[model samples]
Target: MTTQHRTIAFIGAGNMTQSIVGGMVASGYPADAIFVSNPSPGKLEKIAAELGVHTSQDNAEVANKADVIVLAVKPQLMADVCAALREQVAHLADKLIVTIAAGIRISKYRQYLGDDIRMIRVMPNTPSLVGKGMSGLVADDRVDDSDKSFITTAFDGVGATLWVSDEDELDILGAVAGSGPAYFFEFMASLQKAAVALGFDRDKARQMVQQTALGAAEMAIHSELELEDLRKQVTSKGGSTAKGIEQYQAYDIDKISADAVKAAVKRNQEMAELF
Candidate 1:
């Protein structure tokens, strides 16, 4: 089915949902067919005004009106939100339920929304706000191929997507790509600070860092060579890049990055348990 025929209801009108809605509308999906619900009328008003999508304060109202329901609320509030919609979900066997709330597993949702719900769990990062997201998706066995294709198409409007076999992989990808943007941001900030300390202005440092980063990432995406080969190409035998690489190796940066990802994974597990 085409996007125009599908009515997607966003249960929360947050930045991420707004981003998805914006991308969908830009990609030719009918804005009038999209519905957004938020507890706060201010967000709903802004989204409706900006995207021209329908908005509501009642989650169930939105859910009842759509073929797809997106649970975009925070994990801490998911239980309460699901509880409020439990009754309306009984006849939703034909509808697709997609959750973007992190750490809340499918089992927890089943406990409230029912075991037979055609649910899919998606882990998407904040970069989706700029239409450059990396999303990891996993779905319940009950979700058919058509549902999977439709959901994948929707996310593709924002950026790339991957389908993993199990929900555990979502947690792992969450550690990698879901929280990955912040790691890059931190690295860029460090570069900017070092450049400033070396006598460059902050704006010039940031511009240099951002453009270099953009170029490097684009090269990686388009290059057939391995990343290590790309690095080798940039580093001369005794040049500045080689010296920088030597310092990075000397500091065990690879191990530090691995440990950081492991910590994020552990914290994700902790959140799954807590929320």
Candidate 2:
């Protein structure tokens, strides 16, 4: 199976689906080979008009045609969606099923689809909209290498990919990379508020904080040094940067971050039980 020739179908035309589709097309995945379906026509219309992919209101119709089916719907709706596609199981048995819904485990999917279904679970972040997302993937042992390669290539168009050894780790990855963007956004919002308190206008404060965040992230990506080293490089002994660092340390930022990640992981577990 050549990845390029594989017809990929997105079962839901939500934002994440749109972002992945947009990124894939932007990265030169053939739009004609992509199929998308949704119960509602509005998003379908927008995506088809914008990206030129095949669109349908019928889930089974797209599933029948696709070599790879991406289940991009919300977690709460997953059971119903899979139930609707149960009639087409015979037709879909050989195709790869890729799911992006969080918290739902592969076992749950096997229960929904079939006991022998070859599936891959992916946790992707919002940054995929801009071609810089991080996706963590875990695949069933039954999935072939060729299918793995195809899924990897498909996601790489949107961002970097990491394959975890266990499905349990996928939840941990979800806590970090999955919910990580909002953490940075919160910090940036705090900085913007501080800047406003110090007399900078809201817009200017936001602009400064956002650009600095981007620059810091880019530096971390390109630099060989560890994050602690990078922070030290910015802070001279007893300087203003050191003072700020002292405040963060005094506030137990490490503990705060750990607690946040733990909370996210706990919520993921809860969702799994619910689904």
Candidate 3:
């Protein structure tokens, strides 16, 4: 189905959902066709006022009116939310269900919603709030090409997307891209702290790190060279950049980073087990 013809319902009105809705609105999706539901009126009203989408407190209301339902609720609340809409969802065969809550598998969704429901799990990073999200999508067997394509197109407004045939990769992506932003934040925080200790003002230090990060990311995105090659291009033999690299190596940055990501993967796996 075409995007313009689809009535998409967001089951929650959190930051990620707001970002997706904002991106959709910016990308020219019909605001009136988008429906957002939240138990609290504050967020729903804000989304409606800001994005011009329809809002409701009832999950079944949005499910009944939408052709596509996005489960944007927190991972812990997913089971109860699904149970609330189980009857309404069971009756809607034409609807497509897409979830952004990490760690919850498609089989788990099937168990909650039903085996016949078409569902897709997506791991999207926090950068999506700024219209630069990287999402890994995995669809159940019941989701056809048309459904997948439409869902992909809808998320494309927020940022880049990749369709993964393997469900395991989606969980793995939760560690990588999903939690990747936190790693960068930690790194930048260190940079800012160091700059402050070196006598730079906090705001100036922040601006420096933020701008450098933005420029570096843009370069990585647009440059033809590989990331390591880009790093090599900036680091001359026995130069200041090389000295910094030596310190990083001395601190075992690579191993530390890998361990951190692995820890996140373990936590994600644990969530799957918990939920």
Candidate 4:
């Protein structure tokens, strides 16, 4: 088996895997180069038809044919998949493993493979399906500069990438940036309903909330100032915006957000220890 190129083989053909595969294909990877495999032949065929990539039901075939093998299967299946391909992974002296499953550590990779195995653990969010996600990447000690650079380039196809050395910080980023989009989306949904309650048409309400959310995000993304500064910029002395800020503060929304992220990160750490 060869592990020589960006010819990625995803073990799971689910949505997250497809999000990555679609992003790679859209980023100029040849269809012939990518491969996908699953336990179900029908599922593999479906993904193959959609991406025009090589597909197979045999995980071993994917192990043999692919260079960069992605451990995209669920956490519960991780051990089985790793143990199944332990030899193949060991044979991947040159290939790099990139994992997207949350809370799984590099040590777990070594546990499933060997202590000296080369691997990268990545945490990406659901929004990646639309190419607007952010991912946190951490490389094991065995991974070299070239390996690190390739991962950055590969995940960069989706949205943004943040490289971290401390794997624990990954949990912090995961609970917030990785899971943060859903919260904002839910807030937008609520705001849309609020607009409609004020007699706006459904479409108009949706447009108002959606565009406001997008514009706020764009403003933050393009700004040089910190979030505090950005928030202040929208508030005037004794204005409606200030009054809204006072209300949010009175309700302790800031503390609520902080507590939420802290709780989430804690849950992740606990899961990691158990998993």
* Best candidate, TM-score: 2
Kindly indicate the candidate among 1 and 4 with the higher TM-score.
1
RMSD of each: 1.4, 1.2, 1.6, 2.4
The alpha-carbon deviation from the true structure for residue 163 of candidate 2, after best TM-score superposition, in angstroms, is 1.0
What's the distance in Å from true for residue 268, model 2? Answer: 0.8
Ranking by lDDT: 2, 1, 3, 4
Off by over 4 Å in 4: 1-5, 87-90, 196-203
Which parts of model 2 have CA positions greater than 4 angstroms off? Answer: none
My TM-score estimates for the predictions, one after another, are 0.96, 0.96, 0.94, 0.91
Q: Residue by residue across 41-152, what tens digits does model 2's lDDT show?
A: 9999999999999999999898888889999999989999998887764566688999999889999998999886889998998898788999999998988888888888
Instruction: Estimate the overall C-alpha local distance difference test score of candidate 3.
Output: 0.88
**Worst lDDT 10-window in candidate 4:** 1-10
What Cα-based lDDT does every candidate model obtain? 0.90, 0.91, 0.88, 0.83
What lDDT does candidate 4 reach at residue 82? 85
Per-residue lDDT tens digits for candidate 1, residues 1-275, read 56446998999888899888888888888898899999989999898888899999989999998999999988888989988888764477678899999999899888878777879999998889899999999998998888898888889889999999998888899999998999999999999999999999999999999999999999999999999999999999999999999998999998989998999999999899986
Q: Clash number for model 1?
A: 0
- Would you list the rank order by TM-score, best first? 2, 1, 3, 4
Clashes, model 2: 0
List the candidate 1 regions with Cα displacement exceeding 4 Å: 1-4
